[model samples]
Target chain A: MATAAARTFALSAPLPLDNGQSLDGVIVAYETYGELAPGKDNAVLVCHALTGDQYVASTQPLTGKPGWWERMIGPDKPIDTNRFHVICANVIGGCMGSTGPASPAPDGKPYAMRFPVITIRDMVRAEVALLDGLGIERLHAVVGGSMGGMQALSLAANFPARAERVLAIATTARHSAQNIAFHEVGRQAVMADPDWQGGDYYGSGHSPDKGLSVARMAAHITYLSETGLTEKFGRNLQDRDAKSFGFDADFQVESYLRYQGSGFTRRFDANSYLYITRAMDYFDIAEEHGGKLADAFAGTPARFCLVSFDSDWLYPTAESRHVVHALNAAGAPVSFVELSAPFGHDSFLLDVPALDRVVKGFLA
Target chain B: MATAAARTFALSAPLPLDNGQSLDGVIVAYETYGELAPGKDNAVLVCHALTGDQYVASTQPLTGKPGWWERMIGPDKPIDTNRFHVICANVIGGCMGSTGPASPAPDGKPYAMRFPVITIRDMVRAEVALLDGLGIERLHAVVGGSMGGMQALSLAANFPARAERVLAIATTARHSAQNIAFHEVGRQAVMADPDWQGGDYYGSGHSPDKGLSVARMAAHITYLSETGLTEKFGRNLQDRDAKSFGFDADFQVESYLRYQGSGFTRRFDANSYLYITRAMDYFDIAEEHGGKLADAFAGTPARFCLVSFDSDWLYPTAESRHVVHALNAAGAPVSFVELSAPFGHDSFLLDVPALDRVVKGFLA
Candidate 1:
């Protein structure tokens, strides 16, 4: 299980979006594990959240850490690559070898802010094209959490017959005002970095690492619950028993957030952060479907399962309930549950036994 | 009422805070209306929110616009200034003729980041000193909304005998995880500005205006509701009728936010933004009161009135409810109400007739 290798695939073709614009010479980075069934009926697609990539079950090339979803994709795991053909791809508008803001434009310069604002639906559309390119007519299941959940739901709504089962965990159908406000803050942090230089820092000899790190740190806190933070740190002194009485990360949580921010800047591009967050802010499936959330799923045939963490303030249980209510209104087959997790909105990414059981059972 | 002239006061004195820090030669820029009764018992102190100064009923010197809290501080308005002495002072650690990061340090240079980190309690402490200097022993009422509300509540909890009545609107007793996250983003923005140069831009040729503007724009969105934004400007084009297909503030809301950002840069100092926001993020009445919310107000004699707007996600009704619940647990006399306001958190600064009545009645 530990040494299992996944095959990689890269594409260089112009993929068209529903908005009529085509992403020219697109490059999709993907990894697949296990063998496909005789009829390709056991294929599962794993969508990644913002900042995640195709290295779902392998060592990350940049950070040398285990794959982000390593806890849920190996043998005997929830997704269980040994039982189902598992595929994961770096989404478009991302920095991990995908066609994104950090990719070079026709002039061989990084796209920077010039990258077209791609939506979650656009990302799903690209994945569908990838599936088509692979000669896979249908998927056994599509599963994801957070931003990934947005993509999963988009696939179910945009390409209903492509997947038999859909699981969206810790996500909302649309960006709430609070969500937008938070994204705006992050975007502003990136733009404020003078090293950013209007997102044209490609050959400028410097990246907005400080600003980007701070942005990530800010966002990371939302992914953690107050209870989790208090239990873990709770104003505890960092490295010393006494308060430093200065700005040297006096608390353990402060040091932790700073470390998270600094580490994130090493793997993520500032421009990609801006583009991806803007895309999230612009997402509104209900508005696209004429202001009725259920209309987005009209006549959907896929069975849906949604999960939310009780402590997640980013996409709370209320948000998941809204999605379930919309699914019920659409008369779609759906199962919804709110799991008790102390990790806030990012609980799905952590080791949650109940989440694993639900995914394993639902997929089966 | 339209042409009511506001009385101004300028005092330079040393202000001492509870933290044993003394700000020397502090200038208190303030504006007031109506008259002070012979007994000086009808004084109503109006505390301004973050980013707000003391021009609560006068035209602003920078923008030549009406004061922010004019709707709630004018004659026959909320506190009925005609029958009470209204006092509004620019907060300490502010940029408007107050002891702040932009003010000259002892060496005759702008303090920049050298300004000491001041908490909300420290701000109230300065106000108390100002009141003492003005020969007022106690306030008839202390009214504030948002960050100002936090100050009013702190005064009631920290200095129980200072205020007879306290009206706190759209505020919380302590900074939440979400609040701290947002403030962190803003602080990062200021620090990321190249011109900031480690917050020593006093003698530098450039200022961190761009970064400060972006931060302000991000924070401004939190003050308005999603419904209010959609109703005012939905996917509407900024000036042209169709999508420009480029990032040029395509939507009216985007342009509006940019305008707000730019305008804010003209009147506010970037370093001051950092200092004030950090102060807010560090504020915790419970932490100062033995890690118990109820203990903060133990044996407080001030009558408390807490108000919240229904759509305010920044400091939502839930937060107000938490404060009220804590006050109730402490056996404090408190009244709580969630008012329906379309403008969200900014409703406190807008023309809400119901808010006016509530404030007047509470103060009376």
Candidate 2:
């Protein structure tokens, strides 16, 4: 049945960060599926996006929903977990049982806003610690989409010997100005809520649900394509024959957005959202490597496969192409494709048959 | 000097709305530049966008800044005041001295949430009343961009004999799902504010400034092209050499957005934003005309001119093309042009010289 059980690993050493700070006693929460080969060479690491946890092929305890990539990671599925051991871990700034903002500090108090800012590379460092803990010296492949793709690329670049194959989908090498701007709006929405109480709302009986919901609503729009929204909702009334002439959710799209916004608050923490989005905004492999993106992957041993969606404007095909150019300059073996999809950036997580083919072929 | 003096007019009768409700004692704020001419044949009506007021060719009283479209509407510029009389009016649901949510109702209390939902056609009806009060039947041309373009199209569709020419720039005949979704996010942000107090916070020594600021920030990003933002603010640090590692606007883009959000709350009303955005979301000339946009302009006398900016993703060139197709099907005299500009949807208001030339030639 390949039912995965959640596990947590506390690091034996402090994890260093690019921001000149170190997180002490870091705990990484992860889930594993399939059986590990005796030689331990058939391992594959799967990364999750902004709001994802490490429930890879299991059910989420909070929402009782299937793991985000369950369709692609089951036995004989595209990822083919029967032949490959799969591991997925929660990022450091994430709130999914990992040592995050909601975790206790040295004083046994919730870190809340006092948690040190961490970068994408810092997240990779924590992942590397998890890999070390698992005693897997090298993985057959590391796969991800969206922010997950950033981690896959980060693994390939910063820790060259960690994985043999790197598959990144609908991701960018660096956050664009528009990307930073959008994340900033989300952060502002979260901070603006009076219930936020400067991120000290932990155990307050009242959370910044309204602010987080607004933040989620603003961000949720960016994940879907304009055409998709038009096709799905298209000015259709929510539940009435005519407009309510009031502030009630009149349009189907508005109703859907409100649902997405309110629903997100139940499973996500506002402070963790702030930190993760900031890390994403600070992500710039080129900046980290003397302003030359090619230098980030210099003499890399990993073979790279990059996939972008034609409708994904959040991280368009141009971004993938830019990364391809850098890989080419670095003399790395790489392949790229821009698959057609109607779901925009969310196409990575949606049912895109071509994506399945690409992932399967790349991992093989 | 082509300085426009602010003026206001009270409608002698009630203003009818599409929502089966009428507003009594409606007031419209306006500004006029140059002379009306002996025959009033040289008069030109200019409609303002959502955030725009009646300060077309004058300094804004609230901020002491030049009028938004001053460069395009001066004595010698396009829509030249020397050659024609120009009048600009604040939409009835606007906060610039117009009868909006902030205005008093028959009970002598602010309308607040009690303001009747208005449509673009209803706004034109108020403009028509204002024109009648001035004893001038619209001649020459009516020009607008964005939401103003919606009003221009509405005037041509409903009051076909009011204007000889209609110039709609960077706009659409109907709001797309994406458009409505973005506006919904903004509205939600405002309504989520604790200080909103169910829209009755007026004179309470506090307003939903944070919520309204967040809304403005979200909208401001849509106003510019991705390329423009990259070129202007890329990942540059904000007045510092390195990231602050804290949530204090480390990036220049974040600083810019925060500044914009905070600054907007100073000169704009929160409830008015809600009302105006609602009106825009409800705009669909085709829906009002038996699901055929061509039918909206049937038997129209005005010559139509539509200009779209190539980089505008908000109301892209495709939207203008859609309107042109409808106008073509209706056998209307319409000229369409896609101008190359890096500013995106705000191209109509920015220094897009091609737009200035088009406005001049079309009006001439």
lDDT of each: 0.81, 0.93
Docking class of 1: acceptable
**Model 1 chain B lowest lDDT segment of ten:** B1-10
- lDDT for each residue of candidate 2 in B63-92, tens digit (9 for 90 to 100): 999888998998899888988989999998
Clashes by residue pair, model 2: none
Which segments of candidate 1 are over 4 A away from where they belong?
A1-13, A104-109, A176-178, A225-248, A251-253, A285-300, A310-313, A316-331, B1-13, B203-205, B225-245, B289-300, B316-332, B340-342
**lDDT (Cα) of model 2:** 0.93
When just chain B is superposed on the true chain B, each candidate scores a TM-score of 0.95, 0.99
Superposed Cα deviation of residue B166, candidate 2 (Å): 0.2
**Candidate 1, residues B1-364: lDDT per residue as tens digits?**
3233433333455666545577787766676677878888888888998899988877888989888877777678776877888888888889877778888889998887677777888888778877876788889999999989999989898888888999999988877655665565566666768887898887677888877876786688768887787677765667896445455565677778778888998898887788777677677788889889899999988889999999897888888998898899999999999999899889988878888888878877
- For each candidate, the DockQ is 0.30, 0.92
Worst 10 residues of 2 chain B by lDDT: B1-10
- Per-prediction TM-score: 0.90, 0.99
Q: What lDDT tens digits, residue by residue, belong to model 2 across residues A193-238?
A: 9999999999999999999999999899999999999999999999
C-alpha lDDT of residue A145 in model 2: 93
Displacement of the residue A177 alpha carbon in candidate 1, Å: 4.9
DockQ leader: 2
